[model samples]
Target: MGSLTRLIVFLSIFAAITLKSNSEYLLPITKHEPTNQFYTTFNIGSSTKSPVNLLLDLGTNLTWLNCRKLKSLSSLRLVTCQSSTCKSIPGNGCEGKSCLYKQQNPLGQNPVVTGRVVQDRASISTTDGGKFLSQVSVPRFTFSCAGEKTLEGLPPPVAGVLALSPGSSSFTKQVTSAFNVIPKFSLCLPSSGTGRFYIAGIHYFIPPFNDSSSSIPMTLTPIRGTDSGDYLILVQSIYVGGTPLKLNPDLLNGGAKLSTVVHYVLQTDIYNALAQSFTLKAKAMGISKVPSVAPFKHCFDARTVEKNLTGPNVPVIEIGLPGRIGELKWGFYGANTVVKVKETVMCLAFIDGGKKPENLMVIGTHQLQDHMLEFDFSGTVLAFSESLLLHNTSCSTWTSQK
Candidate 1:
């Protein structure tokens, strides 16, 4: 063989090998968000009632309570846990349980830390969209660590793990249900790597999805943690949007998909929700039944998804924490919802208020490669008025003495 020919062949082989390796590291999952959403955290039992100033997961399902820790609660204050507004006393940690806790996690499992309304800090994302809008929450809550139970060493200092039947644990039910809908997964919350908060968009705002949406049925599977026992969601797929991604069975062999959806489940609550941005497509999907513990026994669909969302261009600005990391810079958005792109419903996200996430947004999982992301801490079901039974709230001043 000629030298030049041989050299060309050798280089071609080398390039092929390199590209293959890179592909494994960053496989492309569709960019659109397919399902509703998920959270991360579990339960917070009777542990130290002291206020913890750590980050929290908005979708947490921790069991909550109003304790005697806050001695200064005024009668006029209608509280379920502790504080009224989170922005005012973002780091006070005095609130034990309040209405905010109940409003978010409908399951009533979230240990009521002092919940409060966040002061709005509007930031512009799109100027032409008219009024650029976006802001961070103020007066976040502080959980009490005193009088809390300590089981697994891995439990968030404030959110202690809770154990019991699925009916008893909020996370257990949600995680299991989510697992049944999708394939199982090993959640990756690499803080040391990403150095940012978790990303959850669709899960928080309950971004409007398919009109016929229904919860995936699943059961809780118990596992041991560094501290004590925790639950994991045994689902069918771990998808970016609609495609089912394989799970690290080794990591979750015995673990559960802690009640919260994967996004908001975090050690602390950052400025973002618990979801990623992407465009999903389902083609030639199938379904099989698995054990009761296994979420679903089938693969329902294999289709593609690439669509956007619009409502008379209401032009409402939505706020979100970072979604995915690219080039080492964190990104934020005012409104990160769905956008129709070439007949597909993809997750539309904004880029630091630069690119409108709603502009027929479409993303691919390969874009999320080599990045660190986390979700919420616990799976606290918020008690919305419409869904009151799942959750109940009364912000009005009540006389529930500690």
Candidate 2:
């Protein structure tokens, strides 16, 4: 109740948070190589008319377009609750309620598609990278194919329904399902400056790039779940100055937080919190109470890497925890980095367009040769120590407290 009493309470809480009972370490190395790039194109029937340079996203199998952003199709119709020609995707007859064009909701009642031809309104969705939000133009425009060939076992578009069920009977469900059917794929965006692939690889002769510049292109790890957990970038662990590392709350991948969780990267890592806001206010769904980092800013390095550290055969990223676990490279102190308890994970930082980059994490042979996998289980609490546990060599690569 008093000032001194309040200070004591605060200290007690802080102690509870900082205390470490036990810690774990994940494999510190990873492997990577070249792979193919995946792309998708939509054409009317069997014509050479590729409209949208749509990226093939098994995560979004349903082929669609920015309904209003189309180049004026010959005949396109917008389905409505009240339209004589409106019809369900056939067979999906209404139980009691009904409509002429009953294709079910593609984006659901609050469908991801909503834009009036007359009023150009777009929907906002945080992109997969968690870097920024995108306002997708919408007017619900799917090309009116006169006669389009459907996927092998699929049917063609009839009235309003296109056999383009995106794979599954349900429209939106297909996207995620397709991606799941094939977990990993690669695309070459040499222009975008990203190169690294697990299975599919990439097509770009893209100059090897890194998170910012200090390192080379780090593969985009994907984590799977439902819509809410869909667009996650599941990185095994990050790096700093050639060492496995952790990102502080202030410099968290999701640019710290905003008013609410614009996306999961913005999702707070209570276990990984470094600095608390003075206001002590809880953040919104996709937001953090901490300060924000520069937008779209990445790390950079102008100096050449040490040859020994960048040598081949050395596992840069090791898999599994310590002990007799599935480790990639041999275990050695000062040789292969033995993640210490409460150590800091290096980040991908870049200075102004002026000099050599400092403090960057390079994805060496370990990340390249080995696989960036995801278990049905892993601790959600990521911290300096959590980074260690992630490289646990058979769960025994950890500091046990008894």
Candidate 3:
């Protein structure tokens, strides 16, 4: 079958599976009280009730918990060299017959510190009608306990990391193995309101796509390489309204043989290029008196417009893909790309990655708001759809498809 046919068939087959209780298992994903990192809170340990707050990281494997206080807990046991789980973890020091993990900085800083691995009971609460209700607990949840120090890039109140990326140690894989659900999940980040994270299957906001007209279809692009934790996809072209930006496709790839990742942090050069192109187009489209905002390179005066104006009338940004799949278009008010920074100004939300890698071009959470992003690791493709926030009341009644 063709790719489209194959996707429909796969979704149909997976959707048919009767969940033990409910077709979908839910989790309460919070911003960790409004920080850059999104988090999912869970309780760890067996009778001791050690609460662990883990950062929901799509860029790393190995769910980790800070064990500084609970290092002596009876539930926390070091994985021996003879165990299969120990072999799945990367790193050395196995001669001691204990699983050791060393934190490596992406910027090539020296190894920060190493931690001992352990498996303990972890439980997360579920939501009903948008309110957190009860808990679904899991025993023998594989994670590492911070040994010498707390996990890097996280501070107190934030205890450990929740791995959502592919691999044996990731939470997604472990959850899938334990539950036998489809090895996939969906996330819908809203521009203004609280967003949601679905562990496995659809959020019930998007109606099951039966035909083309009822729902929009997006192209599924494969992520490149094995070791990288990024969700990389192929970008065919980018257009502002009807005008295509004059960007060298190779520049998006950072002159490396590696694939392009839809990054949360937009690299400096790429952002500069996009901002320049957008400014040129906006100026030509009668935004002659553009205002410069601090941070965001592109901004518009909000004085002359309505006080509660949704946003600027920026032209639609279209992202194209290879084959007959389909294009993703960001409308003036739909995609939530335009933001009101101050009472008198509205600016674009694309942030600068500064010195970050050019190949790390990502679809940040800001851009992902008001959209449903589905990752099918079993199929090795990323599927995206416009969220029902613009139409439906809530995702409560939408079909929870695989």
Candidate 4:
């Protein structure tokens, strides 16, 4: 090969490597307090950059939006049913020549909506591992467009659901394929204000948490394989105030799944066990019990609970999971354990999923707030930082640093 040709090939390869190494995307997450739903905003369109807010849903497969409300985009193209993209999508169907997709609304009300698959330009912020760099266009980003009825049960302004499941048509898979980046994403859902959703990036945190110049310490656990496409992990035990709950071994057999949908939902038996244990612990702590609230069975007087930097000084709830060495525990402090419903009233944040529930335990957004969760699809493992509040930091801290 000629010298100039060799030099050009080397430069091309070098540029590709540099781009992949620093190609991280950031999406700011906002918490809707009233609905307890979390959503993120990004620009979608070609000629016009229209900002669309979407709920961050780990259960749904294909990302869908109320596209009828969106103005016509010059770059929008329909995916034909015979295309390879349509074939790869789970539960895909055909409507004439267009690729038809039916997506279950995450809100559960007005259950499912069928739409045609479409691709358009979407804009997102790119980062250089640690800092926000510039706006980048994701050309031909594939998503489905739903009608107005699908918007029911969804918080207003939240145009649609951003599917982050393990399915082929998930937002994570599409982004990974488009950028040739790591097949992983991290979420730091905030209790209030804004947090961050990072796509294929090195996890970075502000000091005290990272003064040693390392990623925040995370407990690694295997992601159990399932046809459901939900992120499931094994929970060996549950503890209140460091004391293990006397749960039937079979109760933990189903495994616990992580969700962005609802607050912690435990099976009837499991909920009874946990609530009973927590009540006893609270009694010992001299925390006064109040009348139970609607969704929550255990209510307490917020005035009686001591205040701490981390949150209300309540007994820590720990979830024990299988780790590389011995078992690892993810603990939830007062910030994540209890929610204040009214003045002087706070209740345990767990909800009863009733008998014969689909999953034994579904860890919800309430317990996940202020904590960093890395979902590594390539590794089939989840790396988690228990609570940022414990480190005098929060999910918002990551965005503020940028």
The TM-scores of all predictions, comma-separated, are 0.21, 0.29, 0.75, 0.95
State the displacement of the C-alpha of residue 247, model 3, in Å, after optimal TM-score superposition.
1.4
lDDT of each: 0.24, 0.24, 0.58, 0.86
Off by over 4 Å in 4: 1-4, 129-131, 207-214, 398-402
Question: What would the per-residue lDDT of candidate 2 be over residues 163-234, giving only the tens digit for each residue?
Answer: 222223222222223222222222221111222221211111112211333222232222233322222222
lDDT of 1 by residue, 186-266 (tens): 222221111111122111111121122422111122222222222332222233332233434332232222322222221
Q: What CA root-mean-square deviation does each model show from the true structure? A: 25.1, 22.7, 8.0, 1.8
The runs of at least 3 residues in candidate 1 whose Cα sits more than 4 Å from the true structure, single-residue gaps closed, are 1-69, 72-229, 240-242, 246-252, 259-402
Cα TM-score of candidate 2: 0.29
Highest TM-score model number: 4
lDDT, candidate 4, equals 0.86
**Taking the candidates one at a time, how many backbone clashes does each contain?**
155, 76, 6, 0
- CA displacement after TM-score superposition, residue 286 of candidate 3 (Å): 4.9
User: After best superposition, candidate 3 residue 274: deviation in angstroms?
Assistant: 1.6
Over the stretch 152-212, how does candidate 4's per-residue lDDT look in tens digits? 8998879999989988789878887788888889998987888888999675544455533
